[model samples]
Target: MASFEASVQLNATPQEMFDFLIDTENILKISPPDTGLSFTKKPDKLYKGAILEFQIQGFGKVQEGTHEIIVFEEPTLFTEKQISGPLKSYTHEHHIVPAGENQITLIDRLEFEPPGGLLGFLITESKLLDLFDEGFYQRHQTLKKLFP
Candidate 1:
């Protein structure tokens, strides 16, 4: 399995941060424009067992994926796993902790593997890490500005 973790401090309460993250619509607003991300199906509000289907334009083509919310603890933690996608397995956990009177710390932990065996491991360890690093950096920057 390959994994990456990142955290950002936001000038907002846990509830505020959680509320924003739970709204799936905000994903398109924050994702990279090149991703061409759009939701094929999404729940009005995310909850345990909710599944989200989305498409992304990448690798000279479009790819679709479905994310299922496996855990949802309001104002604290949210976890999701890819139910169907290019990946062999994918799991993401979002943790929100109170930092100050009104500040919050947001941490994202992700574990995933591609379809193939050794080649997938090499690709994930090499290329995918950089891709996710850049993506998460952009996401944190956007969250900082949005919450501030």
Candidate 2:
């Protein structure tokens, strides 16, 4: 299994940051070209049963996916699981906390294990891992501008 974590401070209220994140269309604007994301169903808002699809460059073909919004603690925490994707399993947890008056801290955590056993391990080391790290950095940079 591999894990990743990142946090960013947004000069917007928690609700504002949360709203921006829940917008699925934001993916198209912010996601890097390599993600190969294709919209399946857009959520009216973040909830327990929103489905999304994206093809990860290093992962195998067509990775149908869903976002199981497992945790919804209002303007604080939201979590989700990838029901189907290129990985054998994936879970992402997001946290939004008050950073100061008019500011918020966004935290993202991911835990996943790829398929193809050892071959998958090799692939991750060789390709996907670094890109995933960069993707998060890009996302944070984009969000800071939008929310600031």
Best by TM-score: 1
CA lDDT, candidate 2, residue 117:
75
The TM-scores of all predictions, comma-separated, are 0.93, 0.83
Ten contiguous residues with the weakest lDDT in model 1: 117-126
Off by over 4 Å in 2: 54-62, 117-122
TM-score of 2: 0.83
In the range 4-34, model 1's lDDT, one tens digit per residue, is 9999999999998898899988877778777
lDDT of 1 at 37: 87
Q: Each model's RMSD to truth, in Å? A: 1.8, 2.4
Q: Candidate 2's residue-wise lDDT over 17-97, tens digit each?
A: 777777777767677666677776666577656565545444555556666777777777778888776667778888888
